[model samples]
Target: MSHDENNAVLFGSGDEAPSNHSHNPHFNELVDARRRQILAGGAALGVLGFLGVGLPGESQAGERHLPPFGRRNRLPFTAVAVGRADGISVPAGYRATPFIPWGTPITGGYPAFLEDASNSAQDQAEQIGMHHDGMHFFPIDAQYGAGLNSRHGLLVLNHEYIDAPLLHPNGPTVVDGKRVSAEQVRKEINAHGVSVVEIRRDVRGEWQVQPSARNRRITAATPMQMSGPARGHALLRTRYSPEGTASRGTQNNCASGFTPWGTYVTCEENWAGYFASRDSDLPRELKRYGLRSSSRFGWDTLSGDEFERFDATRKGADARADYRNEPNHFGWIVEIDPFDPDSVPVKRSALGRFAHEGLVFAKPRAGKPVVCYSGDDAQNEYIYKYVSRGKYRPGRSDGRLLDDGVLYAARFNADGSGDWLALDLQDAAFQQACAAAGVSFADQGEVLINTRLAADIAGATKMDRPEWGAVHPDSNEVYFTLTNNSARTTADAANPRVKNAYGHIIRWREERRDNSGVRFAWDLFLLAGPESDSRGPNGQALGADNMLASPDGLWFDEDGRLWIQTDMSGSQLASGPFGNNQMLVADPHTGDMKRFLVGPLGAEITGITATPDFRTLFINVQHPGEGSTANNLLSTWPDGPGKRPRSATVIITREDRKRLL
Candidate 1:
């Protein structure tokens, strides 16, 4: 059957909600026009003839009316809610099953996950890490072909953070502000890393994790290579790797991306806070990068040299001997070839860093530079893009193709025009700025090591907590989730919202460069909030669709369906103003968004990916029913019936045997 016919049969056309007259007549008109356009497009696609779906009639004479939030269901598919009592929650009609949970064995004879399971640091490497976030499934075909039935392949997932308390038999404790137990610290270290698991579907169409030779885990102690402009820089010199040629491991692997050639790009964010340092003990360079100044979480107070190095203070003596190089090793995008278990992950310095979120690659076209977009993921950071020096060679499987590139920081102007400010340290403007700032750099290595400072000197536009990004399937437009910023940043023209507790999704379309255009047009696609409290077209209050705060994870399926996930705090969930953190699907062309699924209590729904056939969707439910103490558990979710909640990855598939797109 044709794709259009399938969509119509899956998602009926008459699922639109009833309209009600309320506020902002102009917004009402826009809503009506959008509905009309969707109906017309659906008919043009021949979706109306399939399944006997009827289209809404056109009328411009009625009174202004607004639809309730999440009332419209233009998309074809049903949400299926699933969880292990304390696991993630999905929509109805869907079943959620676990792929791999914490402490699950990978290889090397590690045993299955058991609460309070005792294991050494090396054994922990063989087990699954904590807090599974963004993930991608690369199907293995008979000959690596692109067919839906090709279900055997590798699943690459990022373990964002470790549950330090439960990871060890005893919690990570400190005596007199010093970590007393080395074993506890070691367990915490081993519990933070990435897991690559091999999965396959059986003859009955059930997905299961199968142990394979390719299955491996890259941990904190693993030796990694440094590449690009920042290789062998003075700042990277550490006693562990004195030559500055290598670093220990990748931490804070949050959201992630996949290369067209089949590699995993896991991002390291919030690594600075892991270290501890005092103002008087830090170097001038360390203080400049927001480290040593003040740490949000004081991990340095723990005892031993291992925990002390976590604090990037200049304690030992010389720069090489001291822990000065600690901060330099982090905050870069780490790339790993999932297929090769022994491959050393490369921290690509070409992608300028700052709280690096995941990196998304655009479809490579001939005569155009390979382009990738990334977000800084801080309260007032910036969105960045890297354009490769050479055109992307499709179907190439080598890992070296991503090593060389030109990084650019985005500057969104008020006139709907945006410019990609070049981040090359060799540029005349950059050199002059560096000299003026008294920041002397020997080469691009220094620039990348201190990328946040370089972007600052270049006067890049600071954004509001930029998160995961996705590329439009048909139009090539790029969309990113700008999660809320609570910092009291003044209202500027580009970001003209005050105390933006509720965030928005900012998107732009390139003018010419495929996805590498230096010039582009941009706009605020949607402002998330409850329908009764949002400002409409004329700046008046009106009901909006799919209102929620803090947009975090974003993904676009092969069918151009945009999935938006939320990461709301406990306070927001407790209040009746909104439902549990959920995922919403929208049609970008018509601005039609609907809430697809609501997660379990105290859980933030994140890290979503779809199967090749669009029949299965995978999402991560992190920290379910969090903030529940030993006495007052707000929720008894996946661990229902007297059990604690465990963060997990849920595979969602419809039970009716219909396609989910």
Candidate 2:
């Protein structure tokens, strides 16, 4: 996919504290008073309707056509106006605190963050990484804030990419076609992968990271194990992992998923852009995966073979000599056990490989296989799901079930119905389809390695740049953001707009509510745009309160409030009404949406999570002032003026310590 904006954490205390705790007594009192006011209004309206007069929201028959608010669904808040603010803006009753910015020291002996944007590679590795994206918080069985496991936890976050100029003293320098600084390249490499550090709240209720032995950085150079179908495949036979059972680092991590067993799954997105392959005969799998000439960052330009491995071109007589297979090692769902920094992150190949945005599991049922959903965040790509071959056993993190699974790609039919086409090589139809396309899929390994091609051959439906997918905490239904596909010339029934720059959300329920079921029903949930009433594919228009565009990050809080985030960059971000990639909340049933929070200029609101007690919320503001260059500075956020912009996480809480609706 071309350069674009995108999408993402955890908690503490082992005592199983009460899920409901209002730390801010005033905020609770205010919220309660607000609820009481609404109740009184409802009573007045009921009486008016009984007197043959109409209520404010009533239909002619004294009944509402749409679902009522808070029958476990509602957006009971005022929508904030869009603006080009240079900082974050939350709801009237909410307050925000900045925490864990890039290059913030997470390990010992790290230099203080240089406001001028000069930090060494080694120093960066010892600090919080740059471009924070998908993240999770794994509680360490201790309690600190709000007296409800509010403080102690491992905060595992992804550094999707870096601001090259800002990361180096004088920006990246390529002199006579050769990088002048290995330290610079190393810093860029060290700024990515995942950051696992301990975080807790203090007596003042402010969240902060407390460095410990568990604080570790997994960069692009970290060793990663390859498991599943493509574990030992010939295509993965690189010099480092000569046995083809391992690879180094995960790159371009975007969104993420977490397993009940406590491991975090970081998605590898836009990874193919890192490799350069000018040879047309370099195999279709490589070409199909978007490996073209002229790599981004050009990390391989740095001196010596240590940094040159980023270039995935053919070299030597066999695979053991060069990094051609390195690209194959990426694009798969990677699992990291945050609880154990010593545990090697694994590439679960059975999940199938693609531009994985996020891996979200359906509520795992007893005696049933664990199932999860993922979206290929690229133009015209397909949605996918994985079903473990082994049954899920509660309280077991080492399920081994992830080592074996069945991967299926979605085929969204026009009649509000869809099918999950099996992507297994053993499937007769898939075998014939691959054969028809002149592809050699001899085993499960090939199928998983070239999953997109398999999906294409199986006639799986192409989507409008499917981004992040999240399963509802209560409904067990899945929702994914199709983040604006500018490539479509003709409308597909599932994606109605020919050039859908303003994205829509598509949701589906599995047949019989079975996570592994093939058949399903789907409908457009929200049609995003600047218009007050934009109609979805189903001809349902969202009311004035929900105007938005390019929906990217999405998640459901424990109380079932759906949080919506946007990534409207390019011209849209600078001038569009959706303004500055705001975060909003939606009532899934009634279609009520309100802008809950807005990020700083040139930033994408992503990586969202909440405390189990719903007392606090965390969201990442990535690449703030992304429009700026090293010299042309655009945004200076978190700390105002004269400092280089850095991606950081924002902590929000209701004034009364109650859960945000």
Which regions in candidate 2 have their CA more than 4 angstroms from the true location?
A: 1-73, 142-148, 397-399, 536-544
Q: State every prediction's TM-score relative to the real structure.
A: 0.83, 0.87
Q: Assess each prediction's global lDDT (C-alpha) against the native.
A: 0.66, 0.73
Candidate 2 lDDT over 1-661, as tens digits, reads 1112100000011111111111211111222222332223223111121112221221222222233444553555567778788998876888988888998988768568987767788888788888899987766762222324656777788888877767876566665444567887888888989988888888887777786888889998898899987888998898787889988888788898788676788999878776666555777568778776656766665647667677778876988898888788889888988767788989999988788888888988767889999988877677998888788877653537787878998876543456788898777877887787787776899888988878877877767778988887766768889888775565443344557888878776676444677766565566677554355322345444556789999898765567888988888987755677888887665444678888899898899877667788888999999856567678989888877888998989888877766
Give the per-residue lDDT of model 1 (tens digit) for 1-661: 4433332322111111111111211111222222333233223111111111221222111111123225355465554332213444455676777657667788878666655456776677788787788888767651256535446777778877764434555444544334456766676677777888888878877888787888988876677998877788777887776778787788788899987667789998867667656647555345544563433323455666556667676756666787767888888899898877888999988886567789998877855677899988876677888888876666753446566777887776544556777777667877786677677767777777766666766666666688999997776678898877666345433234456676777776665536665676565556665554342212223243356677889999876668889888846776755667888887654455666777887777888876777777778877665654334456655546555456677778888756774
Candidate 2 TM-score to native: 0.87
RMSD of each: 12.1, 11.6
| Displacement of the residue 118 alpha carbon in candidate 1, Å | 4.7
